[model samples]
Target chain A: MAKKKTSLYREFVKGLWDDNPVLRMLLGLCPALAVTNSAINGLAMGMATTFVLLSSSIIISLLRKVIPHQVRIAGYIVIIATFVTVADKFLAAFLPEISKSLGPYVPLIVVNCLILGRQEAFSSKNNVGRSILDALGMGTGFIFVLVVLGGIREILGSATLFNLQILGDWFNPWMIMILPPGAFLTLGILIGLGNWLNERKVKV
Target chain B: MSLLLLFLSAAIVNNFVLTYFLGICPFVGVSKRVSSAVSMGMAVMFVMTITAAVTWLIYHLLLVPFKIEILEYVSFILVIASLVQLVEMFIKKMSKPLYDTLGIYLPLITTNCAILGLALFSVLREYSFIESLVFGIGAGAGFTLALVLMAGIREELELSNVPKPFKGAGITMIVAGSLALAFMGFAGLI
Candidate 1:
C-alpha cells in the first residue's frame, strides 16, 4: 500500500517536471506557441485544455476495459472531441473575450496530441485515480510553461505583465517579441534552458 | 484575382507552420531529412486539400441544412480520421511506390492540427467552396515550404554545432525563428 501510494505520487510529480508535456516531452507544441502571445491568453488556453484533458482522462480510464483494442483510437478521439466541444462552448458563452482571442484554437484542442497521448499512454492503462492525477500534473506543467512563456513575451513585447504596466516609460518594447518569430525564439531558448537544467541535475 | 491573392496570403504572407503555428509536430518531427520532408509535405498537401474540400461540403450541405452546427468538431474530426484511413488504403491499392513513401505520414496527418486548422479557418473566414479549396492548396504549399526549408537548414546544421543543450529541437526552433523573420518580409506583398 505504501509503495502504491508512492508510485501514485510519482506519477503526478513526473508530469510536473520529468515529463513536462511542452518542455520535456514536447507533446503539445502548437498551442504552446499559438495562443501564448499574452499571459492571460496562455492562462485561459491552459485552463480550457486542462478541462478537456481531465474530463477525457476520467472517461477514457473508466472505459478502458470496454473500449475494444482496434477502434480504441477512434473511441478516444470522440471522447476528446466531446469534452473539447464543451470547453469551447463554455468559453464562447461565458468568456467571449478570451474565446474570441483563442479563436479556432479552442476547437483545435480536439486534435492536441497531448490529450490523446495521455489517454493512450497513461489513462488507458491506469485506474481513474492515477489517470486524474496524471492529467492534473501534466495540465499544471503545461500551464506553467505557457504562463512563463507568455509572461516573458508580454513583458518584453508590451512592457506589461497581465496587461499591467510593469516597465517604466524608458523601457522600449521589443516589437518582435509579440510576433510569430518571437514565439519560436522564446520557446527554443526555453527548451535549451530545460535541457541545460536537466544535464546539470544529472551531473550532480 | 482575389483567389490568387488568397492563395498567396495563405502560402507566403501567413504560413501555416511559421505564422499560425499549426502542424508544428510533424514540422519538427519529420524534418530531419530533405527527401522525407518533401514526401511528407506532398502527402500533407494532398490530404489538406481534400480535407478542405470535403469538410466544406459537409459543413455547408449537411450540417447547415440540418442545423447541427454544434456537432462540428466531432463530425469534422471523424471525417478527417476516416478520410486519412481511406486515402491510405487507396494509395496502397493504387500506387505501391507512392504508398511506400507516404505510408507512415498519412496516419500522422489525421491528428495534424494543420488539416483541422485549415478547415476551421475556412469556416471562420466564411470562405466559399472554391475559396476554401484554394486556401487549402495554398496552406498545404506553405506548410511544405516551411518544412522543406527547415529540413534543409537542419541538414546543414548537422555538420556544425556549438552548444550541447541546443542541439536538436532547440536549434531547429531558433532556425525557424530566423526563417519566420525572413518570411515576414512577404507581409507587405499581400
Candidate 2:
C-alpha cells in the first residue's frame, strides 16, 4: 500500500489556492461574514486572525510529538485561544476603534474552525516550516476573500471602497449592502457565483 | 424592568444565530431534525448558562484582578472546555434519556461560537451576574427557537425540489438570509 507522498511544500502551497479555507473548504464563515461590511475592518480582522493562526500553527507543529492523540483538539484550541488573547489585547491597546468595532469577534476566534482545522489537518502532520507555510497560505487565502468581500460591500453600501469616496453623489448606497442581511445575501450570491464560475471553467 | 429589557434585547432584538451569526454549525448541521434540534438547543442552553457564570467568575476574579486581561481568550476557552466536560458528566449521571439525546451535542458545544460569544458579550458589556445569567438564558432560548423553526421548515423543504446547486449549505444560507430578514423585524421590539 505504498503510495507516493507529496512534499511538504505542496501541502503548504495547496492551502493557498487549491483548497483555500474560505473559498473552498468554507470552514470559518462566521467572522468572514460578520466583519466584512467595511474594507478596513475586514483587513484588520484578517491580519489579526492571520497573526493568531500563524503563531498557533507554529506552536502546534512544534508540539505535535508531545501532545496525546485523544487530547489533540483540546490542545490545539488552548494554543489558539492563547494567541487570540494576545492579538485581542494588542488590538485593544493599539487600535481601540477597530477593536471596539470588532468587539467580541476577536475573542470569538477561539472557536474559529479554521485555526483548529489547520492544526489537525496540516500542523500536526508537517514540520515547522511547512506548518508556517500552510498557515500563511490559508490566512492569506482568507484575507483575499475578506478584502474582496469588504471591497464589494463597502463600494456598494457606502459608494466608497476603503473609505475614500469612489462614486459620485448620484449613486445611491444600497443600505442593505452593509447590514447583517447584506452579509448573508452577498455571501450566498458569492457562493452561487463561485459555483457558477467553477461550472463554466469545467465546461471550458 | 431593565432585566426584562435585557432579555427581550438578547432574545428578540439581538438573536444569537440570526443577528450575530453564532453557533451556526449546529444551526445548520443538527437542525435537520426537529427533535434533534430541540435536544441540541437544550444542550447548548445548558452549557451556555454554565459558561456564562463560570467565565464571569474567571474573568472578574482572576483575569481583571491580576491585570491579565490579555488572558481572557485563553481562560474563557479553558473554562468552556471544562464546562462542557462537567455538563456531559452531569447529564450522564442525572438522566439517561437526556444523555441519549443531548450527550453527543454537549461535547460539540465546546466549539460552538455562541457559548463563547455569550461569554465575550457579557464581559464586553460589563453585565452583572444576574444580567449575564438572564442574557445567557435568553440567548439560548432564541437559539432554540431559531433552530426548531429552521428544522421544521427544512423538513418541509425536503419535499420541494430545490435546485441541485442550492441543495445543502446553499439553501440553508438562503433560508438563513430570509430568516435574518425576518428577525430584522424584531429590531423595533426593543
Badly placed stretches (over 4 Å) of model 2 are A1-9, B89-106
In candidate 1, what fraction of native interface contacts survive? 0.78
Model 1 ranges off by over 4 Å: B91-105
What does candidate 2 score on TM?
Answer: 0.91
Model 2 C-alpha lDDT per residue in residues B109-131, reported as the tens digit of each score? 88889999999899889999999
Interface RMSD of 1: 0.6
Question: Any residue pairs clashing in model 1, and if so which?
Answer: none
Expressed as tens digits, the lDDT of each residue in A149-170 for candidate 1 is: 9999999999999999999999
Candidate 1, residue B119: how far the Cα is off, in Å: 0.5
True contacts kept of each: 0.78, 0.50
What is the per-residue lDDT of model 1 for residues B65-164, given as tens digits with 9 covering 90 to 100? 9999999999999999988888788878987886776655668787899999999999989999999999999999999999999999898999995499
| lDDT per residue as tens, model 2, A98-200 | 9999988988888987888788888999889888988988898888878888889999999998889999999999988788888877776766666666667
Q: Cα deviation in Å at residue A190, candidate 2?
A: 1.3
